[model samples]
Target: MKKLTALALGTVMAVSMTAGVSAATVESKDDLKNATIGVQLGTTGDIEASEYEKDGATVKRYSKGSEAIQALLAGQIDCVIIDSQPAQKFVENADGLKILDEPFVEEEYAICLKKGNDELLDKINGALEELKEDGTVDDIMNNYIGDNIGETPYESPEDVDRSNGTLIMATNAEFEPYEYREGDAIVGIDADIAQAICDKLGYELEIDDMEFDAILAAVQSGKADFGAAGMTVTEDRLESVDFTDTYANASQVIIVKAD
Candidate 1:
């Protein structure tokens, strides 16, 4: 009788443990299915979410990641998708948001130059290669991204064309540590990279700070040489402008205040 009681107790404990583990392992994909998701207009996250979930899941567009986050807080959307770095910053600063464990898509970020501006592109690509070889890219990324740097090394351009000198870069100087205003100077990762590329090619670097949605039009209208506001390469964007080989990879994340 004593042996049978001990065996029953052990069996119950084992079942309870298994049940707990099963509950923990299960994730709610249904929560995202057909749910209204928020994303920034003209962003990779927006493109990917639109493409990947073709079931007509309602997508709420915002002018910026912060706005999307605001919508999420206001219960306007079920989720907000944005780059991991900015997401981290947002999550650290905001409240009640959480990043989903699964990434909706993986993408590379790159500098976008005017289609015919081969000279400037070559110079920028060349500088990028040299930066990779000498670890300059790693150092700069570390300064801005810190310990969040991922596994891939800075990529070098395999081949480049060098025919045109005119280059106009468009960016939104609102995302800090990546692109933002330091007094009158537009400064951050994108700005620094643009400056380096111009210096390498010996071409004048013209920067236009504007709303994020206006970037693609600026590029399409030949009003800007390229768009490089931490731009992500997505198929939807590819239909509008050509992107260079990816230089960086990042994911969308959610930010909420710590519990």
Candidate 2:
């Protein structure tokens, strides 16, 4: 009877431990197989995480990365997949989450315009190349991210010409340190970069905020002149619109409960 009781106690402890951690802990990419994942709708993270669905994983989509993080805090998801910079920002603000050291995917951010719009595309590409060459792109990027952040903000030259009329940029404003709302204004790395591009090309810049998923469609339909919300170049996206030369590099990362 004593031995049987000891065996039963051990079984209970084992089950309790498994239920507490093994069921929800995610330490690596492979662990996503059949796991519950959270991601912002239409993001590359969502696209990649959806692949796990074939392995029985269930993916919950949210409008913003912050929403997915909130769902994580509520125990509604086992993990969140998002871009590295915004993931870092979210983890800094949230007490119980951590971005895994392993990166999920590498990507390059670019500006998108409607297909067959080579005239605008070529002009934008020219502006982008000049920006990269003169370090304006680096200044804009450093101002929002990295050690020089907030110390190297980009400003439009006082003598910039705007005879080319206004160019509307479509973006999602919920992504912080990239493109997010600051009071009534939208600002971030991507915002400054777009402004610089417009300044170089003699156009007045106008920003239009919308759902991340809808930015591409807006550009494709000519509702917006371009899309620049930290958007990446993917083969799937190429079918709908043409992308400019890459302006930035980013990675997808996994966020899990720290404890």
Best by TM-score: 2
Kindly list the per-residue Cα lDDT of model 2 for residues 125-236, writing each as its tens digit: 9999999999999988888888877788888899998998999999998787788876688888888989999999999999999999999999999999999998889999
Instruction: Give the per-residue lDDT digits (tens) of candidate 1, residues 1-259.
Output: 0111211222322232222111111123445555677788867777766753677567778786767666555555667777887676665555466766776566688877666667656767787786667775666576677775434333324443434455678998656556766557776677766665655565556779988889988888888878988888766677777776556777665333223
Query: Where in model 2 is the C-alpha error above 4 Å?
Result: 1-23
For candidate 2, report its TM-score.
Answer: 0.91
Please give the clash total of every predicted structure, in order. 8, 0
Root-mean-square deviation of every model: 14.6, 11.0
Off by over 4 Å in 1: 1-30, 147-167, 254-259
Residue 34 Cα positional deviation in candidate 2, in Å, after optimal superposition: 2.5
How many backbone clashes are present in model 2? 0
